[model samples]
Target chain A: MDAALTLLSFGPDGWGDDIATGVLVTVGLALATLPFGLVLGFFVALMKQSEEPSMRLAGNIYTTIFRGLPELLTLFLIFYGAQLGLQQITALFGEETTIEINAFAAGMVALGIMFSSYASEVFLAAFRVIPRGQYEGAYAVGLSHTRTMRLVILPQLIRVALPGLGNLWLILLKDTALVSVIGLSDILRQTGVAARVTKEPFLFFGLACLLYLVLAVLSSFVFSAIERWAAKSGGTR
Target chain B: MNAVAADLVERPPTPSRRWTGTRIAGTILVALWALAIAGLALYLVQSWNPELFDRYAGRYWSGLIVTLQLVFLSIILGAVLSIPIAWGRMTKRRIPSALAYAYVYFFRGTPLIAQTFLIYYGLGSFRPQLEAVGLWSFFRDAWNCALFAFTLNTAAYQAEILRGALESVGRGQWEGAASLGLSRLHTLRLIIVPQALIVALRPYGNEIILMIKGSAIVAIITVYDLMGETRRAYSRSFDFQTYLYAALIYLAIVETLRNVIEWIERRLTRHLKR
Candidate 1:
């Protein structure tokens, strides 16, 4: 027990600092991706709802592909292909500048795209959960489409979408570990380094699992609270 | 709207989307999609390499087999293991229930990759003891570790599904079975399980697909699954399309499985269809 404590201790001789930094990185990565994913998901959900069949088809194709592919595959695609894509675009301008996508950015983009695909489904369902009356009621009052959505629909939509998006956030929190594979200094990576150096693989990896579980359990609590808060106002009223 | 939702008074009115139909939104979406689609086509044309495709075809096939094998074996084994766990979860007994809950919570709470690494690397620390117990060889292989982790992970999920499905069967079924003088076990096996299984079918399909997508993590540990093969090909050839091919293959499998599951659902629930 003492040895374990010393190994996980807070000072220079211990890896506590490194692991703490990793936890920060992991949490930051997830937080940064949240808005990107939410916005992209909202956009795609709108795309699926568009008047044009092509727009709808594009939405369907995007969701199907991103949601179906493994997050790691998407990460690899973004990591390797994004650079080439930038180079290609630059070539068109005859400048040929190369843009390298770091693992953190790649993970962020891949997970954001994947999260959006799933989120769009939740948002779509949330929209559907709002009764036709809400739209009719808003229009009956001569509200513009944008106003109807903003003032009347979105508040309720967020309520319906909250639970689903909350679930996605927990998943995103966990999936952040995947970026460690591409060389990001996330929780798993830090623990992994300590595990190798200390030759105490079980202890370090178990710690990694514990940290993730703690995050998930905490998020579950936070989400339920938010759900309760959101539901304080009546959906029907 | 589905007739059932419409007919079912307690269910909410079929939810309707509040869409952004402003012409500006539509124009922006069109422009963005067009650029995306056009760029994809250009990239495909510019980077098509026939020779690399021919060279890596065999590797991808073999890797796919490994992936399929890993997912199927673990899923089957996990299904078998989940029976008792599910039963424990449903039982009135305290110790068994707590243990089962803990098992599910831990497995479900953590990431698959972390779980995978723990099994793969963590077990090696017990090499001496495992060798003494004559289990070193089994724990040593990356493939076995992946399989073990996947099985443990999927079993918890399957247990939840089983418990939920079994509970979804109405209280009347139990009363009907009891009045018929059937034993509890007999009633569950003969009547309740069948109905519950039909309810469980869709979740089972979803679990299998998740397992397929997740099995890619094993490649990180050098198990040479489909994703593993892609990484190897990428290292050797440095072709971005290798990852694209794997992505498409994965997509094809998921799409195919989804349709198959839907078809099976239709067939199995044919009697209930209106």
Candidate 2:
């Protein structure tokens, strides 16, 4: 027990600091991904709803391709395939610089793109639920198209999108563990290293499980609170 | 009134003929874009190494078979195990419900990869104890560990889904059964379960799809499933095409399953559509 405690301590002999850093990296990846995902998702949703058939088709294909592929396969394709594609493009431009994508950036882009595919569906559903009268009402008030969206549609969209987005967030949080396969020093990867170095897989992996559970539980509470707040605010509006 | 009447008179009688130049252009552009995509796909297929396929075809086939096996066995076993857990959650007893909740919470909260590692490597530390109990052989193999983890994880999800579906069966159904002098078990077996299963079908399909995606993680633990074989081929060739091929195969499987599930859903709910 003492040995185990010492190994988990923050001293030079222990990997406590490493594990802490891993947790931070995982959280940072998720935070960075959230906005990218939401913005792209909103854009895709708009494209799907566009007046132009081509735009709708494009959006449909994008969502179908991304959503159909496994998240891990998407990561690998982006991480390795992106480099090759970039190198080819640079060669065409007569440049010699080799572009490298760090695991974090690759993870962010892959996860963000995948998240957007799912989120677009959620946003599209939310958009569909808005009464047609609301748009007509906005027009009757002499609001511009953009102004109508901002004043009349966006708030309600967010309220309806919140729960689905929250569920996606939980999924995204768990998916960050997959980044470890690409050598990101996230919680799972760090635990893997500690386990290998200390030759105590049970101790380290079990601890990693506990850490993940703590994050999951805490995030669930946070989401529930935000949902309640969204409901209340939406009611007032 | 004159301007409104003029506008109405000028409009085309047929909607199809009302397609302006811009609309025609949009249609043309969409067609051109689709052609470009088709051409790109054709180029990739032509460029693919046929010799490589011939050499690794057997390996890929076996990998695909293993992946299907893992997904099928785990989903079936997990679904079976979920019934008791779902029952525990639904019961009035506090302790059982809490225990079931804890099981679901822990499994759902963590990543499957973490759970896989904990079972595969973590249990290696307990080989001596397992051997003492004559279970070391079961824990020693990576395949068994992967199967075990997948089963446990899916059971938690399936349990929650089943519980929700069962509860969604209206209380009136239970009351009607009781008033008819049917016992609780008989009611559940004869009527409630069938209805609950129909309600649960879609979610069950979703869970299976998720497990199919998640079974990829078992590759990390040295199970030479589809993803594992893909990785192996990639390492051998150092070509990204291997990954694309694997992705294409996965996409086919997912698309097929999606269609199958939709068909089943339609068949099950055919009565409601009327």
- Docking band of candidate 1: medium
RMSD of each: 6.3, 4.2
Off by over 4 Å in 1: A50-52, A91-98, A235-237, B1-46
DockQ score of the complex predicted as candidate 1: 0.54
Sort candidate 2 into its docking category.
medium
Model 2 chain B: weakest 10-residue lDDT segment is: B13-22
What TM-score do all the candidates reach, one by one? 0.91, 0.93
Most accurate candidate by DockQ: 2
Best candidate (score: TM-score) = 2
In model 1, pairs of residues that clash are A128-B15, A128-B16
lDDT of 1 at B268: 97
| Tens digits of per-residue lDDT for model 1, A1-237 | 899999999987798999999999999999999999999999899878767666777788889888789888888888888888888888999996768778888889988998999999999998877889999999999999889989998888898899899989988998999999989999999999999999999999999999999989888998898888888874544
lDDT of 2 by residue, B1-274 (tens): 9988987786655656457654576577577768967875896788788888887778888989999999999999998999899988999999999999999999999999999999999998888899999999999899999999999999999999999999999999999999999999999999899899899999998888888888888888899998999989988988777888888888899889988999998898888895
Supply DockQ values for each candidate.
Answer: 0.54, 0.59
User: Model 1, A80: alpha-carbon shift in Å?
Assistant: 1.1
